[model samples]
Target: MSKAEKTRQLIIEKTADVFNSKGYAATSLSDITKITGLTKGSIYGNFDDKEEVVIAAFKFNAKRLRDSMDAAISKEETAYEQLMAMLNFYKTTWKKAASQGGCPMLNAATEADDHLLFLRDAVKDNFIAWQKKVSTIIEKGKAEGSFKVHLQTETYAYTFIMLIEGGILLSRTLNQITHLNTALDRVKLIIDQEIVN
Candidate 1:
C-alpha cells in the first residue's frame, strides 16, 4: 500500500476498538489522534472529519468480524456443517467480542438510535447485509434438502440476529457469558427443530 493508504489504515485500525468501546458519540477527534498518534491535521488529512473516521473505523471493525466468521464457515462443506460452523463461531464469540466492547453492529445500532444520526444509514445497511447473509445460508440449506422447504428464510434469519444480538447485550450488561450461551442454545434448537428437514 501507498504511504497515505497505510496511514489511513493505521488510523482506522487503531481507533476501531476505541469507537466500539467508548461509543461513536462519545469518541472525539482527540481520542482518535491520541490512539493513532497522529496530529489533527494529519488525521483530517486522511479523513474529512470525525464522522468520516467513525464510519471507516466501524467498517474496519465489521470487516474483521465478518472475515473471521467467513473463515470459520468456509471450512465446512455441507449445509448443516456450514450452519453449525456459524453457530460455533458465535458460541465462542463472547471473548473476542467482549474485548472489543461487544459486537460492532450492535454497538453502532444502539449508539445510532438517536445520538449518531450520521451513522444511521451505515448501521442499517450493515444489519440488512447481516440478515441477508443468514438468510442466504438458510436458502442454501433448503436447496440441499437439509433444511425444510416450508421454512421462512428471512424470519429465521432475523430471529437469528435478534437472538444473537440480544444475547450479546445481556451477556455484556450482566457480565455473564451464559446469557449469550443460552441465546445461542435457542439458536441451535431452532436449527434442529424448525429449519432442519
Candidate 2:
C-alpha cells in the first residue's frame, strides 16, 4: 500500500473502536485525532471530512466482525456445528464486544436511526449480509438433511439476529452477560428442536 493508503487504514483501525463505542454523532474529530495520534490536518488530509472517516470506520468495524464470524464458522465440519460455532463465537466474544462497546451492528443501528442516514443505510446493509449468511447456513443444513426442510430459514435467521442483537444491548446495559447467554441458549434450542432433523 502507498503511504497515504497505509495512513488511512491506520486511522480507520484506530478509530473503528472509537466509533463503535462512541457512535458517529458522539465521536468528534478531536476523538479521532486523539485516538489516531494524528493532527487534524493530517486526518483531513486523508479523509475528506468526518462523515467520510465515519463511513470508513463503520465499514472497517463491520468487516472485522464479519471476518471473525467467517473464521469461526469455517472451523466446524457440519452445518449444525457451523451454526453452533457462530452462536459460540458471539458468546465467547462477549467480553471482547463489551470492551469494544457492544456489537457493532447494534451500536450502529441504534445510533444511526434518525441520526446519520448514510450510516443507517450501512447498518441496514450489514444486517442484510448477516441475515443472508445465517439463512444460507440454515438452507444448507436443510439441503444436507441436517435441518428440517419445512423450517423457514429466513425467519429463523432474522429471529436469531434480533435475539443476538437485543441480548447484546441488554447485557451491555446491565454490565452482565446473563441476557446474552440466555439468548444464545434459546438460539441453540431453536436450532436443535426447530431446525435440526
Candidate 3:
C-alpha cells in the first residue's frame, strides 16, 4: 500500500474501538487524534471529516467480527453445524466484544438509524448479507436432507439474526451471559425441533 493508504489504515485501526464504544455522534475529531496520536493535519490529510473516519472505523470493526464468525463456521462439517457454529461464535467472543464496545453493527444501527444515512444503509446491508448467509445454509441443509423443516428459509434466517443480535444487546447491556445463552438455547431448540429432521 502507499504511505497515505497505510496511514489511513493505521488511523482506522486505532480509532475503530473508540468509535464502536463511544459512537459516531459522540466521538469527536479530538478523540480520534488522541487515540491515534495523529495530528489534526494528519487525520484530515487522510479523511475528509469525522464522518469518513467513523465509516472506516465501522467497516474495520465489522470486518473483524465477521472474520471471526467466518473462521469458526469454516471449521464445522455440516450446514446445521455451521449455523450452530455461527451462533456459538457470539458466545465464545462476547468477552472480547464487550471489551471492544459491543457488536459494531448493533452499535451503528442503534446510533445511526435516523441520522447517518450512509451508516444506516451499511448496517442494513450487513444484516441482509448475514440473513442471506443463514438462508443459504438452510437451503443447503434442505437440499441434502439434513433439514426437513417446512418453513420459509428467509423467515428462519431473519428470526435467527434477530435472536442473535437481541441476545448480544441484552447480554452486553446487562453484563451477563445468561441473556445470550438463553437466546442461543432458543436457537438450538428451534434447530433441533423445527429445522433438523
lDDT winner: 2
- Estimate the overall C-alpha local distance difference test score of candidate 3: 0.88
Q: Rate the local accuracy (lDDT) of all candidates.
A: 0.89, 0.91, 0.88
Worst 10 residues of 1 by lDDT: 91-100
Off by over 4 Å in 2: none
Per-model TM values vs. the true structure = 0.96, 0.95, 0.95
What does candidate 3 score on TM? 0.95
lDDT (tens digit, per residue) of candidate 1 on 1-197: 99999999999999999999999889988888899899999999999988999888888888888889989988998778887888889877778889878899999989888788888888888888888888888889989988899888899999988999999899999898898899888999989998899
Ranking by TM-score: 1, 2, 3
Sort the predicted structures by lDDT, highest score first: 2, 1, 3
lDDT of 3 at 155: 94
- Across residues 1-197, which tens digit of lDDT does each residue of candidate 2 receive? 99999999999999999898888889998899999999999999999999899889998899999999999999998889999999999999999889978888888888789778878888889999999999999988988998889987889999999999888989999999999999999999988888888
Q: After superposition, how far is residue 23 of candidate 1 from its true place, in Å?
A: 1.2
